[model samples]
Target: MQRAKFAVTLFATVMAIGLTGCGEEKKPEAPKPEAAASTPPPAATVEIKIGTVGPLTGSIAHLGKDNENGVVLAIEQANAAKITIDGKPAHFTLISEDDQADPKVGTTVAQKLVDDKVAGVVGHLNSGVTIPASAIYHQAGIPMITGSATNPQLTEQGFDNIFRVVGRDDQQGPAIASYLAATEKPKVVAVIDDSTAYGEGLADQVAKTLKSEGVKVLAREKGTDKTTDWKAVLTKIKGEKPNAVFFGGMDATGGPLMKQARELGIKAVFAFGDGACTDKMHELAGEAAEGLLCSQAGIPPQAASKAFLEAYKAKFNTDPILYAPFTYDAANLLIQAMKEANSADPKKYLPFLQKIDYSGATGKIEFDAKGDRKDAEITIFVMKNGKVEPIAVVKSGKTIPFDEFMKSMGGA
Candidate 1:
């Protein structure tokens, strides 16, 4: 009986083990794989081309390069900021062209930019170049903003697409002439200009203002933009013994004229317009640069915003010569208008640009109905310590001391 009981218990234990093994026979259904990561595709990007034209290969190439650098810096900053238009990431591309500061070349460059489908343009530094190039851009419905061109005829042509960041030559001419009349108190002043549109136009305004001030004006003297030797003209003017002499030309020629005037013992106070108002004057004119008076259509380079100055130096490893701040502002104005309008098309953004009131590296920037900068300031400078230092700022017919103007602007 005991043997029979042990056999029955052993059979029951085998059945229990067989049932447990059958219940685990699915083999855990093979470990399931993880779903692939659901990464959204990269955000859609749009390429926007912006054109910049200047005298990239001539005497004023430095100034043109400065303008180009300004636009480049602005584009770089805008890209880094991830600027978007119409829900698409904007990748700005700079298309730089060399105008050689020639109007013919300027028009060609402008056409090239238009064909390239650039959203906007910031260049043609010379008024002569800007005037003709503007027509091309207008025909293409492309907006063009000049940072240095000051000829009033540019905006007077009634093209809504034309704009400038600097004051007009009409405004600048009177400011410098008024300052010269008040300070020099000259009984007679001689006016000279390079035969270019900008130089002749500015010189005409100066002559008019001097005549209005009851100062006897000598007949206009002429020189080409490339005239480096002015000994003949200087000798002729010296014979007249004018109390003051004003040159409406670029520093490239103006500097040599000033040095030659001094060497010829002209003994007259030398004054120049924005073209000659540069630190390079010291290098160009040597010791003769000192005590020379000049006027800039906008504030001095030193008067630009601190943030802009620092960034400019860091990016270019050099200080801004002139008009870079304006160009920088011009480029930003284009981008800002596109963002405001939510479109990169020139027709769509042009309206926004017309109505924009932007605070830029230079200062508050707004446009008049004529597309000229409103409330633009003309700064009178004197060469001191090999630098063009501001002495006064003329804005809206009111003259303010440089220090006072800077304080009003919250410092440079």
Candidate 2:
């Protein structure tokens, strides 16, 4: 009986082992490498191009670079933030083009940007270029913002796609004229323009305003944009002995004019518009820059945000130039529009961008129906000890002292 029980127990144990093996066989197996490969990867990121066109290879290339750098800095910040447009991860691709400050070249560049399908454009620093370029961009339905081009007709042309970050020449022209009448008290102010659309238009406005203020305009001389020889102009102006001389042109031309004016014994206070109010003037004019007064389109650098200054310095290894602040605002304005409209297409976001009231480093940035910046403040800088220093600010044609301007910015 003991032997029989042992055999039965051994048989049952074997059966139990066979049943457990069958149960293990029914379980699911792991997937193979080939099967795993069938799963799709995450969606690829999308790209949107932002065209930057300016005079990247001309006499005022420094100003162009400053404008370009501002846009680049804004793009870098957007990329760092991992910007998403239209529900997809979007990257901003810069399509930079140089027009050599030529209006015809500007039109070609604008068409190229249109053909390249750039979503937006920031550039053509000179008014001569911006005015003609506007039609090209408008035809293609591309929105463009000018940071430096201040010609009023640029906005007055009725182009819905055009915008300007800086104040118009009319605003700046009248403000400077008022300051000159009230403070400079010039008996006769000579006016010289480079004969380009920008230089001529601005000089005309300044002359009109000065004449309106009962200040006599001594000479409305003409100078080509590339003229380095101011011998005749200076000789004529010196003979007149005007109390002040206003230059409506860029730093490249303005610098030589300043140097030559001093060299020719023209001992009058030199005044300049936004086009000539660049930091490059310091180096270009050398010691002749002393006591020179110039007008810029926005608030003084002293009131710029510390964060902006620090970031700009860290990125470019230099301080902001005349129009960089406005350029920064222009770039950010478009990006903010893209964010709000939830689209990267210029046609979709342009209306949003137009209506945007962005408070940038410049000031409260609101656009008029004509695409001009509203409530624009013109900052007047004086060359003191080899640097341009803000002495006063004018808003809506009212001159405010430097101290008072700072206080107003504080909301006091």
Error of 1 at 287 (Å): 5.8
Off-target runs (Cα >4 Å) in candidate 1 are 1-43, 102-104, 184-204, 210-268, 275-290, 385-388, 406-412
| Tens digit per residue, CA lDDT, model 1, 1-412 | 9999999999999999999887576323211110011112344766688999999998999999999999999987887788878987777778899999999989998999998899999988998899999999999999999999977899999999899988886798899999999888999899999999778988999999899989999999999999999999999999999999999999999999999999999889989988898889999999988989888788766677878888999999999988899899999999999999999999999999999999998788999999999989899999999998899998877788898877766563
Per-prediction RMSD in angstroms? 19.5, 17.6
Candidate 2 residues 113-151, lDDT tens each? 999888889887999999999999999998899888977
lDDT of each: 0.89, 0.83
**TM-score, structure 1 vs. true:** 0.73
Off by over 4 Å in 2: 1-41, 44-46, 184-292, 298-303, 385-388, 403-412
lDDT of 2 at 240: 86
Measured on C-alpha atoms, candidate 2 has an lDDT of: 0.83
